[model samples]
Target chain A: MEKIKELDLPSDHISEFGDLVKQMHDVDVNMCYQCRKCTSGCPVAEYMDYSPTQIIHAVRLGLKDMVLSSNTYWLCLACGTCTTRCPQETGLLEVMDALATIAESKGIRSNAPEIAKFYETGLSNMRFFGKLYDLGIAGMYKLKTGKLTQDMGMGIKMMRKGKLELLPTFQNQGEMRRIFKKVQEVEKKARGATDK
Target chain B: MKYAYYNSCSLRSTGREYDKSLRAIFKKLDIELVEPKNWICCGSTLAHNVSRLLSLVLPLQNLAEIQKEGLDAVVVPCTACYSRFKTAQYEIAENPEMAAQVEEVIESRFEKKVKVIHPLEVLSSEPVISRLPELVEKDLSGLKVVSYYGCLLLRPPKIMEFDICEYPQTMDKILSAVGIPTLDWSHKTECCGGSLSITRPEIVRKLSRDLLEDAKAVGAEAISVPCTFCHLNLDVRQEEIEREHNVSYRLPILYFTELMALAMGVSEKDLLLKMHFVDTDSVLQKVVAR
Candidate 1:
């Protein structure tokens, strides 16, 4: 069994952010006995460079770079199989989510460019419209990531089948703007806290 | 009771039959489905996986509109939408602080009091189930249907609470009510690799093929489910599954509502079997023949 390492951080970075991580540790991260049950059950591990167990280990060690840049961070589908199967009742998925939040804050880009592009477009679409328009978001993602030509045939077929509507069906633009403003406010607060 | 019906993305596109059948069934049961004005996608699996906060907020905004209409509950026909809505509801109901944060994020006073019900729960209620036999003009005496209750409908059952997490009997009970003999099968609550159907086709193919083969092992001629995403995965992906596995298995997958509509004397054409990639004609013929 691999010995668990305690998180060591520089004095400057030790504040509410560290406290936030501790609050997330309410899920009994210490209960993980290196069973590797999470790794075995993870569907994405086959394609991921690091398994779920490894991601947990990295987070436990506070190896920010290793945890953030790993494929497992972006690849987890949060199926809850790991959490369900954990003998020690470790909320593995929740821990991964908190880690992912940390990684996002750090602006650690994913090796999978498509995944990041998808998130950006999705967030932008939600911010602008207060809802997701799949066709529009997909188009925007493709344009931004230069993957437009990859699945042009599928897009053509979808359009032909009336699956891809050209225009978004927005009921109230005012409501959307209000929601976007609120999100911006929340993000601003979090950013301020991080800066302090 | 009236509900703001969210047909969701899949039902609007690939699984439109589910929408048609659900509306018809709800109409007969005296349940009024008030379609929301200019509704958008529920963010489904994509939004939830990418950003949890954003996903919760998007669905909460939609629910806010439903609340504004004075409806207590929103009837979601698509399983993914039902699961996501139910999940958001649970999260909001449990974590008041997170709810407040989400409420702050959306700039709306969300009371965290709305209930999300899947169409199956509404359709398979005691009153609805009791009225099934009387409503069935055509007896599905011979259709060997396997009720596939995909992962969303069951798991994380703490949120869904509609049926048994492992072996749900709602669909089977409804099928039996309409005189359709359901196959006693395992793998009912198995994962279909869902949205991963797009992101990871090979994995989905292997998982879906194994599920199809398991259903066939139990002598199921067709499979029925309450989820549009599962329907798309099991039915449309049959071609890809067959290609990848190097085997031919053309088992038609029907939305549970489609079968209910059929038993209630709805015409096959009206049920939109034509929209399905897998032809259900052979299975329907067996039922007619019996």
Candidate 2:
């Protein structure tokens, strides 16, 4: 396994982000032995700058900036290959998620603009519509991320081919709104409990 | 028997044939499938992997809806949806506190409780398979198939305890009922790299190609699977894999329901062979050609 540089995290940093780090630790972050097995099994490691092992390491060190800004944080597909295969059985995926929560809480956006935009747009669309309206979400994502110009020809061709539907079929809009509202309340309570 | 049908995203969009065939086969089997009044994507592997809570919430909400209808179980045609629902159920059932939290969340939202079942489970049940012999209009004598269960159907067995995780023969047994022979290939429970097809095509291509080649090596004329995602990966990605690996591999992938429908004498057009990225006509035509 490649040796990872140990960062000398500031004393105040640990105190400031203690709760978030504690939540991450609750996922058994300390069990990692730098084996890199998680990285080896990760499907998205090739696409990420930081391997799964490195991301976990970053979380343990309380490097919020590194944890949030790294492409590994956003690029992770959460396949559970690492978590399932981890020698120590540490929930490496959950740790990454806790890191993501902290990142999102701090309003730290993904360095990969497209993925961040997709995440925001996809979640907001789901929250509002109670289900994914793929075409609507795609259009919104394209418009927000400014990639609409690059894929204009392809989008048009897909529309012409009848691959892209202009209208979405929603199942139950009122019920979905109720569900989203409940989830929001639950998450808010969970966050508040953690803060206390 | 009546079931709450949880049609995952693929069935609604890309794999509509699965939805159609499933409904048709159930009707033929004298089974009533009720689509949940309000359904959402089961979050599949993506949501589960990204956020365990989000993944659990989606399926738990669906299950709650099924419970509201007073149904004990749901028949999920999509393998990913089955896996997600089963996983959530297992987790919730194991942890009472978490289950309470989930129930509170779901009850507050939908005011219901729900159980889930995969179509394979329903199809393999004694009640359904006992009628198989009577329903076979065309025996699949010429069709040689390899039943690909994929990881979702069998893996994390606590969640998917419906069949033998290592070597499930439910699909094979159902296929044999209609006269199709199955190869005893060990790749039945192998991973197909599913949506990884989109995030990482190369890995999916390699994994899918290996499964197909193994099936072909064992003299399988076609590969049959219960998961639409597996069908998409195995069938659609074969072209790319063949080009990438420079191999002349052409394997027609069919949903287990489609095979069942074929044996039950459904027409080719109704099964939607034209919609498939890989042409099933060649392999299927041989079986029904006479």
Candidate 3:
């Protein structure tokens, strides 16, 4: 998906963010009661600029700018730990995902650019190959991030063990391209509705 | 028992050993595994992060194909792929709007009832578990390992519906039945820095180190896992984690299927134990003839 310009701030940014999350993910942020259960169970809570509970609270209070600006969602592992623990069944993973897609839609640069690049590289690989080319994705990620020598040793060892594929595999590439196009169309229509 | 096998991408590459051992064990169990024609990737974490619709559509499309082929169930060995399939079904069942949107994207109706069985669930099933003890041709009770469920198999309890999320017993149950003893330990459902193993190796090192330390403290000789990313982070990255942290954890990460294959008298060479980054010889040597 191509990056687009950020939309102008709406009168009620809180409702805008909450409504979009509710509409898109079918999750209501209003259900979170500030119990901090999500924050407590999160594996990467220590690394997040704003913890999962705080992000949920921010969403409730309509602190979209603050929530989107933080590195919290980008660092989220999406392991579903908090989602499982929440008594409210708030679907924390979907909330984090909404924040991520929203950040990308607004063209707000992620604080964790490498993580963002990793997702972008992976999605592009899937769109083109119909299957994930692990070797290709790793090679491209290393080249793009300039971490060429970071895991060079491990890469060689894996290659020798026949664990890493030397070539890309394909399956129904034509249908995959069409599916990707349809997804883009759906997302674009959703974006237009939210912007209005 | 017949079912379609969904190897996903990892089994074809980094986790090929898992594929080898699983096929080996299933052959011994007398279960038929059929690979559906032209099965595509499940889109894994990458799809959901980009567009929620794509994630559901990808796996839903695969399910549609399996259903069309007259198969009602599929065996998904990779936990990551299994989670995606489960999540897709959960989303569709929970939200009709999503179901319609997914139907529109894939140009097909998803058979939400199609069974997505992980190897852990398959092995622990009544038919298989009951026959495990007699199937053993080699003794493996000497090898002690902790069962690491990682995140996908048991998390988001509502969606997965496999085992208890926090204190899962499925892996341990399967291991014990085959005369393989598993140590009780924490970090069963903990996240292993998953896909971040690539983008954020630092975090993976820290998280994986904690898990390895916990297993060592519990006296586990090795770690067994069901997910590809978990195996890659815990097994392949063991050396890097050791060097970066100034410690050595020679714990070999093993697939539970490999252990079963060993018990069933599948040769060590056939199990692909040598392909692991950590030396699995120490654990392999512990197996005695029954």
lDDT of each: 0.71, 0.71, 0.87
lDDT of 3 at B207: 92
Question: Total clashing residue pairs per candidate?
Answer: 0, 2, 1
> lDDT by residue for model 2 over B23-128, one digit each (tens)?
8789898899888777776666545433446667878888876777778778888877887887777777656645665666677443343656788778778878
TM-score of each model's chain B: 0.95, 0.94, 0.98
Model 1 over residues B105-220: C-alpha lDDT tens digits? 76568664777888877768877778878877776877788999877766665667878775789889888888888988878877777755544556677777878999989988
Off by over 4 Å in 3: A1-14, A189-196
Winner of 2 and 3 under DockQ: 3
Cα deviation of B249 in candidate 3 (Å)? 1.6
Report how far residue A61 has shifted in candidate 2, in Å: 5.1
Top-down lDDT ranking:
3, 1, 2
Q: What DockQ would you assign to candidate 1?
A: 0.30
**Which candidate tops lDDT?**
3
What's model 1's overall lDDT? 0.71
Q: RMSD for each model, in Å, please?
A: 3.9, 4.4, 4.1
> Which fraction of the native contacts appears in each prediction?
0.14, 0.14, 0.73
lDDT of 3 by residue, A6-69 (tens): 4464444446678878887888888887799999998898988888988887786677788888
Query: Judged by DockQ, which candidate is best?
Result: 3
Cα lDDT tens digits for candidate 1, A1-196: 2344565655334334334554633444545667998888666678877777876656555565666677675666656667766777777766766666666656666775566556667666765664556688778877887766754665565566555556775545566566656765775675577668
Task: List residue ranges in candidate 2 displaced over 4 A.
Answer: A6-26, A31-78, A83-89, A104-113, A138-166, B45-53, B94-104, B108-113, B162-167, B184-187, B196-219, B241-247
Docking class of 3: medium
